[model samples]
Target: MKPRLAETPVLLGWAEAPLSPWSRFGDDEWLLDIRTAGRRADQNRISWAVELPEGAVISRTAWRGLHQAAKQFLWSMTTNPPTGRQRLSPSSVHNKSSALKTMIRWMALDGLETFSSIDAGAVERLRAWLLVRPGYKAKSITANTVVNYMIVLKDLYRQRAKLDDAPLADPLPHETTYEAAGLTPATRGSIPFIPDAIAISLLNTALQWVEEHGQTIVRAETIRREAWALGLTRGARRQCSYHARKALRRANLIGPAGEALLGAYAVRHAANHLVEACYIVIAGFVGMRVSEILSMETGAVDYHPIGETGVAQAYLVARLFKTVDQHGGRVERWIAPEPVVKAVELLEQLSASLREASGRRELFLVKNTQYGEIVPVTQMHIGWRVNDFARHVGVPMHEGKPWAFSSHQFRKTFARFIARRDRSQLFGLAEHFKHASVAMTARGYVGSDFDLRQLIDHESRAETATALDRILLSDRLAGRMGERIVVGNARFRGRAGEQVRRDYIEFVLTETDLRIHACDYGWCVFQAETSRCGGEEGPSEAGRSPSVCLSCANLVIEPRHAPYWRDRRDRNSDLLSRANTMTAAVLTEAIEQCDTVLNRVGEHDEQV
Candidate 1:
């Protein structure tokens, strides 16, 4: 008999599978084909590696015992559903198994190798160890990473009953995964919204490209394909000789009604740029994930009216693969603006030849560089395009360095643009966006596609900070709330209007728990308990309901907002002359409300 080391892994062969589900794999391997795993590219490679410390070989019994537990964890993923079991993908498998591997390897060093030896105290110790390594300085592990490690322990407890070397009791029974790992709202990270200048510039350039050069790019593509199909072209311009370029150029490639595309030598590269340009327009306007955008097929965009209003709204319909299992994630819709719809239509044309060639319906297909076969473009590809597009368009620098653009920034930025104004301007900031009709822009906010409220609140606070910064410098202000602010600022800010330092204002902004919600007409210095137009979450829920806010005490009408009120008074007075008796009463009341606002700021001709 041989002595067993406490550190050696053991008992591998206990995990087994039936022939029905095992038919796809060889006797020794369980390889997963990730082609249909809601991914456009192969993303992760999952495996387990176990051994004793200092290069010592793990004994056969010990290796199999740990392997048996690892295999049982893997088997739990393969179970058929309606059984409340989850099917794993390469990404999830990689995340879960990598956690398991790290835990076991670290455990061996501590002289505990078996699942039976891992207790609740051991699990808590493992979490603490993962978060703050013994030798490393505060190279803090992210909340997500720690939470992922805790999940491995929780799962081990879940299948303990089924495994031969399973733990005797639940190792994480008292603590939930997040609680044990110390993850909370303050800990989880979020990608920041794109800076305003960069976003507006990027979107404007993208829209211009789709509007002006879209048909030219599509025409160029059609000519290249027609030449290839007729055997006039051998391959790309570089692959073919100069003779091919001259020959294609001589064809005059009259598109539709005598319109011609670019010179033959430029066709291929222009088609590629055209796709990137469309990516910015669609992704910026709609706030879709890069993967979701790549999954789209032809005619995925449409303008449909919601109710009897019959005002058309643009939307992109695509399946979100983030929650993919054997049953995939739900279909997601985005309230796209007109620019998004235009970009989508242009993309359909630009991608038509390649889509037909590949026999795949995905709109974001590109030719594989090495193989010339079409495949879906990955996030890395778009990430490169984002920076390239920024450089190409000369997007302005932020704080001295060129602003780095990413696909993730658009979603956060879009959420802020909506939240900052309570979605009053939603997509209709005509000065910036050159938006469509008011009715159409108004419809951009109402859809099943948008549910980023928590993120919006976070960003809305940021927007409020900017607003307060500007307000603190202003000498003249109006409304009851504005009067209070003026009196409040006079104390520390000095009666001479000497500027208050921004850091001091920010300190007060945070310390007092101040919230400033801006609207199209004015600002609302919100105190949820006293709000008239719905409180707390009300502005977000009602899309800022400025009509109701018009009478609220929280309203602060600045000098900048007086023009809107003056215009309102004039328009209502004009309407009263043409109104019938019942309608006349409504117009008279509207005029009175506007007069009340205009008189306070001295904008009205007649003072009350």
Candidate 2:
């Protein structure tokens, strides 16, 4: 450790003058930029603020050791991490500090006063205690949670030379880190996706508030904020009651049916609900991390059109806080649909007055300021508002209580919603979630939410199972897979009679190496060996498109898909009418393929 005066401790970060990575900060609190600080920003709150633990929370000897270890650990992380290791992310530093604090408190419980007391087998004792530690869950804390506390204990030992009252020796000289905590490879937590009906109700109602009443709520809130700012609400007597009632005649806070939805221009309480609605619309649809959405400024939403595709996708531009593993705070954008765009636009209009007055442009701001300072609302505050919004709209109760709403649940729920209906889900969700595997879902949630892909994959397989069952049961199916399923059912008809197809489907699904990729165009009974699109590698994303499935031997065109093929044929014919020679040839071939399927299903004369 670098020698320093007692008055200028290392935890304050480089004392008076700043050093590399060590910013000018204090012992009590340190605020680091989310852009450069890696995962430091926990929520959409401003730059991450890691506060010092109070000394009285644990024994004085343990507190000194922790404070010393934290100072050296943070200094090493910020200035010089161990060789071959990059600096720890600010959030990582925050977590270690948090874990160590918990360690000291737990040590205090054991009547241990100092880190040096945790020598040799005492580490194992701590691990045993943690294994049975109570949490918010019914069972003892998962081994995964135990890992957080165990790693910090290792840190205190490894850096003993530079720390005061540090551990006497390494805690895990013989055991692996996970071994020390009993964290098995499979000991992980996976959050559940929201139920489908509730998800629909929540999103539809939220969007309704944004699209229908958003503008009025914003306008009305602006008026009220301005009025109160100008000290207009100081009357004790009902001096303006007569004039206020007359002014109510000009109020325009009416719903589509012209009902007084805002109650005579009252919008202060409405603004609270409107903010939560905006949160729901943006977070629910785009699946943005709470930090990213809350970090949005007034002009964050923009139109980004790819002229080549003729698709104008709305984008929410912001500093991505989770990119610190490669780079910190990357300026990126998520593909925001129309509803998301509208929600952000409404927030801009609603917060216009506050942004100008407070001079901070955070979209989610505390309505009332204390001591003339503006404050950004935290994620927990948003949760409370969402509960109120749910009650106001009569969202269904679960187990006799309103369903709990959370930031991650929004992303997970969005995943399942898209998984069921959107074939282009992977690309969109990857872009939105920041997940490299499925979509953009990972960027911020890499530490925990990457496992969410398991849930979506689960949803996909269930959907495929259902589609496969439907196709096998269809007597009038067409295409290669359709013909094969029909013939197989016929071959078993003599043995199983009317239930032959059902038995056949059950056998194939359970016994055979069958894979199905169902889409709006049709189903593709995919085989890696014969697949032209996937080409023996596995299921390629391109295999789901209509063009790729058209000529593939794996294609399965059920009778139900006749209307889709007919509509597609008509649209392509219209394009062919004005196409150049080369394009016209391609269109002609596509039309011929559609005609072949139409003939096979005897849909050439079907109304569709």
Candidate 3:
């Protein structure tokens, strides 16, 4: 009898195929490629295929079909790529798998078997069930999470539709159907920038410790100092360090006197905590993602000339995983300021031994023990180191808890600082942050509550007050001039003048602080929207003429205005001298008005 062929599924075997030079494989050739891909994909499917939670069981028929679909999905996700389409990252694959598992579990619970049994009603029921169900963390399942599940189901159907032998009866609900299912949109919160004092306090505590124990054999102390310096100076802390320090401190390995005991007992283990602290500075100051910062290789920093300037600028070449294309490749040249360069250099020096032993080019690795077992610093480790530092330094409390420092917060704080310093350079900020547009930079980094209105109001009031004071102190106008002012049919003097002055002073002192501006013929108590003067509407163009302001009811004659009136009178007098009988009448009328203005100013001066 012939030897039994391995019972490997076509999709699983395909996923295991080596991805290379056969860029133009046809459908038949691709099927053959799957055969050549080997059994790793089969093994992977076996491992993750039917991982159900305790007490969860499905019908044998349902399991067979569901398992086949899942295997195909996982295999295709890894191996098959549509031309020009980017392959999913490992994290993306994991997330999709998790969603599928949840759906399968729901299918078992509902007693539904096979894709044909899943309809819109089944999906809706699943959504309702998820809404009431509690997550592993015991919190109510969120609508956003439900939306994700719906997306996975939709993708599962989409993949089935592409296959020659699909298992589904009808296509799943449209993408829009999932969207209209009442999922709450996610809201991004504002950036939280720590106060300078708090940052300084944390740094000072770390520095003080480092200074007190100069050049010690305790690896923890050395790592702690390096981490603290990085966090405080470069704003580079790892996500792991945020909460990692708490566990270390609880272990009596990361407190004020923990260093001494740590030195004697677990020096090697303590080294990890110190390494975490160093991450804080790099993340916080450099404003790079935790993944990018951690993935930095040895000698990532290099000096390059900045434009035509003789000064050499430091640049850090690092992989940017978040914004990578389909190929999972992202490289960015970040401008490294002095502090960042220094911090990176120090990190290199500290991790030198560990890097050599591990034969890894990554900048951040720690020795596990005396035997020199090396491991890459993880996000969890960084969290512990940061919290430990914060706790030791007595960082200010918020909501009865010490302020939790995380890598995300560090990036936000960095953005906030840059935006606060200069809002006009938002484009430059966008470039530095690698944001797609200035709008995103503004929305994410800049606060909406900037106080520009108050500043403008204050400046306007000051300018008005200065103009008013100049007119009040002029030689032409003297004491109590507001009382003597007169216009067309209105006269303001004595009690009226005193009232006007009183109103002016009160207005200036009040919160509104209304001010006078030069209007058509005279001054007007107009301040954008705060004008108090009332007058009949005049011709639009003439209404704002300086000549019209002269006869307005709001006009106030003073000694300072005498020269202005005199000039008008002299011009009118000259016109009157050579005027014909018809024009002489108009000239006389104009001269008389000028004389009247001059008389008001002279009389006001006499009263003083």
Best by lDDT: 1
**Please, what is the whole-model Cα lDDT of each candidate in the order they appear?**
0.64, 0.64, 0.52
Measured on C-alpha atoms, candidate 3 has an lDDT of: 0.52
Question: What TM-score goes with each of the models?
Answer: 0.67, 0.65, 0.52
C-alpha positional error of residue 241 in candidate 3 after TM-score superposition, expressed in Å: 27
lDDT string, candidate 2, 225-339, tens digits: 4444444456533434334334434564564234554332456667778888899988887666776777788789777666787866567886666633544466667767666
Flag regions of model 2 displaced more than 4 Å: 1-63, 111-120, 131-142, 157-170, 173-187, 222-246, 255-259, 262-266, 305-313, 325-328, 369-373, 399-401, 417-608
Candidate with more favorable, higher lDDT: 1 or 3: 1
Q: Estimate, for each residue in 251-366, the C-alpha lDDT of model 3 and write its tens digit.
A: 35444453443322244333444454456656654566676677787888988874896977677777766644534346666666444565566567667766776798878775
Q: What's the candidate order when arranged by decreasing lDDT?
A: 1, 2, 3
Q: Show how many residue pairs clash in every candidate, following the order shown.
A: 12, 15, 47
Q: Which lDDT value does model 1 have at 80?
A: 27
